[model samples]
Target chain A: MSGQTVANLMRGHIEALAARGERTDGRGANEFRDVSIETGLIGTAEGSARVTLGETTVMCGVKLLAGTPYPDSPGRGSMTTTAELACLASEQFEPGPPREPAIELARVVDRGIRESQMIDFEGLCIEHGEKVWVVFIDMHILDYGGNLFDCCTLAAASALAHAKIPNVQHGIADKDVDLPISCWPISCTFAKLGETIVLDPNHDEEMVMSARLTVAHDENGNLRAMQKGYNGAFTVDEIKTAVKTARTADKVLRKALKEATK
Target chain B: MAGGNSDIKFIKKGKRLDGRKPDELRKVRIEVGVLNRADGSCYLEWGNNKVYAGVFGPIECHPRHKQQQDRAIVQARYTMAPFSVNDRKRPGYDRRSSEISYIISQALERVVMVEQFPRAAIRVDMQVVEAHAGTRCAALTAASVALADAGIPMRDIIPSCAAGKVSDTVVLDLNKEEDNYGQADLPLAIVPSTGEVVLLQLDGHLTPDEFEQAFDMAYKGCMDIYEIQRAALADRYGGSA
Candidate 1:
């Protein structure tokens, strides 16, 4: 059978399940999969973490290098988040430079960390405008079971939380120190499947879902970043409910992040 | 001769740095079918080196012009992650990577039965996530296993290893420090069953006798690694081969 035919069949089956207030994997409408994280796996990187949300897996590595800070962010450390939808992760992904989906993934994950003010950017400065620490968060998708937005965000945040300034290695300081972090930001992603809103959509659900909504919240439950994806519309009531659901869901994610980093 | 670091003693008595004999290979670990999306995949960790290889296709070749009417083409890309080395490497393909990629493609082409699939392409992507030394050999070894896992028809698995001269002593598997100051380096890949050398590259200098010894050492190392590759494949299927 053609791929489209299989997708259509699965979509119909998923919609039927949704109509009954259930999910294909037997989870509740707002339930998320089990999340597990491992840290410090990449020895060459200053900090690294591998996060598994259900079957989806991502590896985030942070490299600290001394370079000129950006013109707008002079005296503050700069950061660039790059997401590679590695061909090994999914059949749909191709091998090459970052494409549209990969770019969007990076931007969305960046928005969460940057808007949350998770890192102490100014504290990373070694000199006023001459030199500063630049953090590069490279997110590699090892498996794309689905919901990369939340997985990438979680991986990036956890990696940043574990990062250390290799000051001594660069001969700038007498000792190495942890990267300054001020807050923890967690993101929740929901897929609109027919009339139902499912949390942490898997690969099958993603193929059939009409739209995706991702909301990031800081530890204090303040909204930091939000992105709506796909060519689909949602009612005001649905958006409002999504925000409320995101805030509540973040608590569980934050707990897992804390335990993983600890 | 490449300049050697006089302060560092690469070899003493019959043992080399890291306490290994001249002909000893590093500890190796291999796992196959590690990726869910790729047709085949392999992960390898040799000493401090880490590599991942993924294979795609026997599918249609892209760009129309690159396709062959009578056979498939094996395209290999060997890349090192930015943080794989002591100093951060910029992301993107450089001359070194392109050369290694070309050599790896040629090596695998000798073993894979590309003629079976006309007008198709088999892509092998080898990524070095961490590096100490001998990354090319590690990448090629991993790629071979990935090809086997992909179920691509092949005459044999290609196994690779490197031997180099450090401080006037020929040694198997040069590490980072040794490579930087070694007098000579030879990386070799072979079809173990056929005993045919599929890939060979050398730099620095060595006498004919020393070259022969280094080649012999690298061949032995490749043979040992080939056994590990077979064991990894056997382990994937849960039985002895």
Candidate 2:
């Protein structure tokens, strides 16, 4: 993939983008690319949604099953998060072990959801400490460009919100019923590159960025969790700015999630 | 498999559980030019089933050994996000998905003019975000829009669909219940221009009479889906008329 690097002008091209305080794709700092979301398109899954952030496309599906909750959380239901890097995304991602990068991506996505209390695990309990429903969120990055964190988070949350648990029974009247879930958690990710803070960086900015920050918030617009990627220390002022930005972004994102699922 | 014992009422009053009529199809929406890095990409929603497809390459084949001298290779992968299934499928490849991937690749091979790009490969990547009953059909259909969105040349964008029988009733498109209880299930890939079945699969029991009915129903489905496919492609490709 690197052989076509243009050999020399690479640095100069990126320098132009940095100097102008703009992305190679013409996005302004703090501006996100146009986003569209849709839900209930996948009938096979319990719930599913697809989020497109510019060219960074990610799809999320939520599956439900009756199983014993983890021992540590016997009273509450269980949740799991995983990511798949399809060969269709990029040549860089091969079909195996998912690579360490993908694992980190999945964990960051998981932290945002778990911290948000989005699933309402108590509601999933079929029996107290006996049987319960486990929620599974799978994130698949079908295309690679830039800024997957925000896109993936939104997809997962929307999928969860769009999901409907089936009514099951053991031939007992009281045990079987339809359950419609309420509430949701959504995330906003910001990238800091070359002293410019950008929202929804494209594939190019992601390729040569210093650090990226992702923050998840709930329907109430309260911060649920945060994860910083690419290893860089943050200044007090930068952290404050990021928090403020994330808070404001949370409101807008929640609406998007709702619209996507609706 | 949980058999005929479980109680699930799929249809009532000539309407499905979801409130759709028997002949009516789910609402399908599509968007192209998604995933800017890919050669072509599209996202589609058909009722509760969502599919994201990305078409890359006809550029280069890695491992260098996979490259050929005569024509391009068409490779496809169909995967469900772990959350896409009710049981939370373990994240990895599976037999059913692999089978779909292979069939989809072969279906595409016929439409794509691969000989134009020797020693190259075009990849069709499909991800199912939500699984209703007809994900393979939706994903394959979305992949066609994606390939066209990328400006790739094809005989015609492929139209895919499924038809099944429930309680001796042949249906146009099987919802979750019809699929599960269907005496026979047939999923197919069709090229709308030719009305040909490039990929076909069947399970359960179907007499020769039922098979023909399912095939005809599936063919009609392809034509129905083809209208949406053509409109989407034309929107991006510019109006010919």
Query: Fraction of native Cα contacts kept in each candidate?
Result: 0.42, 0.68
Model 2 TM: 0.78
Please write out the lDDT profile of model 2 over residues B64-146, one tens digit for every residue. Answer: 89887999988788887776655567888889889999999999988998999999888888877667788999999999988
- A1-262 per-residue lDDT for model 2 (tens digits): 4312531335456546666876676766777777878776565567777788787777777777778877777888788888887766765566655788888888888887778766777888777778888777777887777778888888887778767776543322344343345456677777766666667767766666678887777777777878778875567788779878877766666677767666
Q: DockQ values for all predictions?
A: 0.54, 0.42
* Candidate 1 C-alpha lDDT tens digits along B1-241: 2456646789999898788999999999999998766789999999989888888888768768999999999989888877677677777678999999999999999999999999998988887878988999999999999999999999999999999998788999998888888888899999988999999999988999999999999999999999999999999977885
> Candidate 2: which stretches are off by over 4 Å?
A1-11, A16-20, A25-54, A86-97, A116-126, A142-145, A154-200, A213-228, A231-262, B1-35, B45-48, B169-171, B191-197, B220-224
- Tell me the lDDT of model 1 at B214: 96
DockQ, structure candidate 2 = 0.42
Question: Which pairs of residues clash in candidate 1, taking residues 3 or more apart in a chain or in different chains?
Answer: none
Which 10 consecutive positions of candidate 2 chain B have the poorest summed lDDT?
B1-10
